[model samples]
Target chain A: MLTIENLHAQVEGKQILNGIDLDVKAGEVHAIMGPNGSGKSTLSSVIAGHQDYEVTKGNMLFQGEDLAKLSPEERAHKGIFLSFQYPVEIPGVSVTNFIKTSINASRKAKGMEDMTANLMLKKIREKSSLLEIDSRFLSRSLNEGFSGGEKKRNEIFQMAMLEPKLSILDETDSGLDIDALKIVANGVNKLRSNDNAIIVITHYQRLLEYIVPDFVHVIFDGKTVKSGTKDLAIELEEKGYDWIKEMV
Target chain B: MEFKEKLLDSHLAFEERIDLSDAIHQTRLESLKTFEQKGFPSRKDEAWKYTSLNAMVLKDYALFPQTETTIQLKKVKKYFLYEIDTYKVVFIDGVYSPFLSDTTHDGLDVCLMSAALSKAKYRSLIDTYFNKIINKEDSLTALNTAYAQEGAYVYIPKSVVAEKPIEIIHFSTGKEKALWLQPRNLIVVDQNAQVQILERHQSLKEHVVVTNSVTEIYAHQDAFVDYYKIQNDLSTASLIDNTYISQEKKSNVRVHTFSLGGKLTRNNLNFCLNGQHCHSTLKGVTLLEDQQHVDHYTLVDHASPKCESHQDYKGVFSEGSKGVFNGKIHVDQLAQKTNAFQQNNNILLDDKATVNTKPQLEIFADDVKCSHGCTVGQMDEDALFYMRSRGIPKKEAKALMTYAFANNVLESVELPILKKRINKLIAKKLGVNLGFDL
Candidate 1:
């Protein structure tokens, strides 16, 4: 569903992602583990078409279509979703309003009518309960004055609402408690399907214990150094990324 | 042969052609003499430091004659009363047209100031408050009071709250080379009465026209009044508005000014909280494009104890437009426990667009809570990126963000229909449609 060939990206003329190649097919869960400066987050941001990152060289293809030419919004319309590391807080805009706008925009791009308010409320209620998000949270401004756990859960709630083809969770478990981590992981596990792909990027294997990945890859210095099965995650968890750094 | 000499020569020539009324002719002459003595305000004047009226004084604007002309009422209805049902009073070229007015509300009195001056009951009311709150030191106020030949006087009696809003539409239309219009209005709300007044000022002609308008509002004890001023003049037209509001005990007063179109526009709004527990809210939105310039100066005075005032003003400058916001809040020594807050925010879109925002707070009582802040900046890049990342185009994203910014003021309006109209105006100003339902 997604392919990257020797992708090189930079921000302010400083190279971040150099010669990164990765591929993911449908119905698979992939975990990319790396040290602090291994370009794990940069790779996700570049694929999501963040304008701040300049793609210096190489090409990224999503479903056989070149993704470099598309804007961030266009990439979103192509069913690419990025769960940000730090969710933005937009004051005076309710969560329901923001989510409705996004869903309507995506639906419009897919040649579908906007969901009615009644239907949307019903769907939101159902998904919110499943994700353990309080109904009152929907009335508050989008992520404004929200705690770290609430913001992460809101991101997962949004993922459920958009139902994108490829979901990239970037540091989703960084500031979450164990309870929140389990809740977020349960939401992700429930969302997995045969027609969709998931990419979980994290530093520790704690989150991996809940949402088990089928494959794990060690990233070093902007390049994928090793690829293995789920057992590789446990091995890296026991022996930190320094061991992988020396191997690279 | 100098620039000032040539400009004064042209001004005198235009001044010679103005024919004043018998009642105000003497006053007009004296005022013009005063204007000549004072001349146009320069940077030497404390209040005129930021706003220079030199350009206006240079252009000799011709005075519009008092004549009855057929106005396209349909266009007025389309723009001002598209969605609401209310009593409408229309004035064309500063002359009241009884044929164009619709006054059908119960216990409501709307009459021309000229006619009201003749009645025994309203004469004293008109004479007592006519230009009373406007400062004589203001050259523009003196100019409007001296030149105003006709105006409207509206009074809502005690214990009577009108069900519908009263709409006052002033249109400037003439075939003359240049036209000068002075419109005056005085609205009084008796004790415990409620009213909403909307004043729409517009000009249809492409020629240069100058509009000097003044509106005075008095809210008695326990009265509630909401006033909205919309200025969408022609490209060559200029406007100067002075609005004075006085509130009594436990009364609530709100004034919203939306400056959308004009070559040069200046609005001064002043509110006096004279009675205890009185509340005043002043909110404004100004959007200027091209080479347009808009200036807004607002003052809130807390005279009595426990009075409160809040002000929020926002401006958007694009292209080569310029905007100025000067807001001041004054808390008297006797007005302890008073809470006054003021903020002026601006967004400059283009490189050449400019904004000058100054928020002033004067507190004579140390026990009062008063805060004032002003910010001049570009749009939030992070917010813009976030919206755009959600599949909204850049233009749409900008419009949404701007709308959100202005909505902070719009949400405070109590009337739904009026709020919706103002929302639509803001949306149009931001180059977007009013598709979102609040």
Candidate 2:
């Protein structure tokens, strides 16, 4: 569902991602793990088509469509989702309204009519409950004065609403408690199907315990140094990135 | 003759038509002298530096309209807050339209200024409140005073609450080729009284019309007053409004101005806190496009101790539009423990748009809290990116941000229907039909 070859990216004259290669098929979960400043989050931003990150070399293709020429919104309309590490707090826009707008905007881009109000309300209620969120929280301004756990849960709620084909979770578990992590993981797990893919980017192996990836890759100095199965996550969790740095 | 000379020439004919023996006549004569000395403000004046009226003064206008044009109620009903009951004082072509007005005299006065000035019962009110709070040095205010004879007159008796809101509407028909109007208003809320008023000036057609209006409001001990001004007219019309408000002990007053469309608009809103523990709120939302100009000059004078004032103004300018905001907060020596804050924020949607914002704070009191700041720029790029990445296109994202930027001021509106109408106006102005309200 997604392919990248030697993806080289930089932001504002400074290099972040260099010589990165990755390929993922449908119905699989990929976990990219690294230490601080190891370009784990940069990979997610690059895939999401953030304007500040300019791809200097190589290309990214999603379902055989080159994403380099597409805008962030265009990428989104093509079923791509990136959960931000630090979501922007927008005042005066309620969470339900924000999610509804996002859903309808995507539908409109696909030449589809808007979902009826009753259906939208039902979907919001069902998805908000899946994340263990109170219905009252949906009416507050989007992420305004929200706690870390609430913001993360709300981001997952939006993901559940949009139902993208390729989902990128960047540092999603950093701000969540154990229960919230389980709920978020369960929500993402339920949305996984035969025609979709998931990429979980994190700094630690703690999140892998909940969402169990099919493959694990360690990125160091903007390059994927090693590709292994789930046991590599446990070993890295115990011994730390020193061995990985030495191997690189 | 020039427009200024025409005004000075027509005042003689207007003087011969009224009862010159009244005390207000003396005020008119003195004000006429003041207007004669100071003429119209030039670009050299410090307050008029950013806003120029050179071209406006060069154009000719009929000082007095020739006909009394009456408009049908069905034609102007949409402009009113029809969802709720209101007492209306409607005017057309600077003349009162009795057929369209719904006034009251049972324990309150919601009627015409001319009747208030001439009647024996409203004599004390006219003597006590009329033309008392306006600045003596303002030349345009002086011009309005020299020709002030018609407008809305509202008086709420002591401890009495006005049963319904009042609507002061002025509609001008393009009967004259080029017309000018000056209307005066006086409102007095006695001790512990309460009232809400909405004022608007609308032109029916695309013609040259200028309105120089003045309004004075007095709030006695423990009284409350909520005043709203809606300035949305055709590009051919211009307005200059001078509003003065005085509050006594424990009184609360709020004034909101909405400037959506006009060729040129100037709002001089001033407030004086005369007694202790008084509160004043001044808020405005201005959206302009296509060579429009709107200037807001506000002043809050804290004369007594333990008084507070809050001023917030926001604007969105697009496509060769211009906006100006000059706010001043003064704290007297005796006014200790005074809290005052002012904020002016603006967004320019086009490279040709311009905004000049200045905040002046003069503090003399030993213990006071005063803070003022202003910001002028485009929309936030990061916020835009965030919304756009959520599947909203660039245009819709920009509109949503702009709407949210100016939406907070409407949250404080007490009337839901009026707030909804203003919301629709703002959405229409942004030219975006969002899936949901922002």
Best by DockQ: 2
Residue B323 shift from truth in candidate 2, angstroms: 1.8
Calculate DockQ per candidate and list them.
Answer: 0.56, 0.70
lDDT (C-alpha) at residue A18 in model 1: 79
Give the range where candidate 2 chain B is weakest over 10 consecutive residues by summed lDDT: B429-438
lDDT of 2: 0.90
TM-score of chain B of 2: 0.98
Query: In terms of TM-score, how similar is model 2 to the real structure?
Result: 0.96
Candidate 2: clashing pairs of residues:
none
TM-scores for all candidates: the values are 0.92, 0.96
Error of 1 at B23 (Å): 9.2
Q: Fnat of candidate 1, please?
A: 0.42
lDDT of 2 by residue, A1-248 (tens): 89999999999999988888889888989999988998998898889888899999988999999999988899999999988898888888889888888888999999999999999999998898888899999999889999998998898899999998999999999988898899999998888898889999998898999889999989998888888889999999999999999888
Q: Tens digit of lDDT per residue, candidate 1, span B295-385?
A: 8888888999998888888888899998988888888989999999998889998899999888878889888888888889998877776
Native contacts conserved, per model:
0.42, 0.63
lDDT of 1 by residue, A22-138 (tens): 899999999999999899999988988888999999989999999999988888888888888888888767888878878887777789988988999888998898789988899
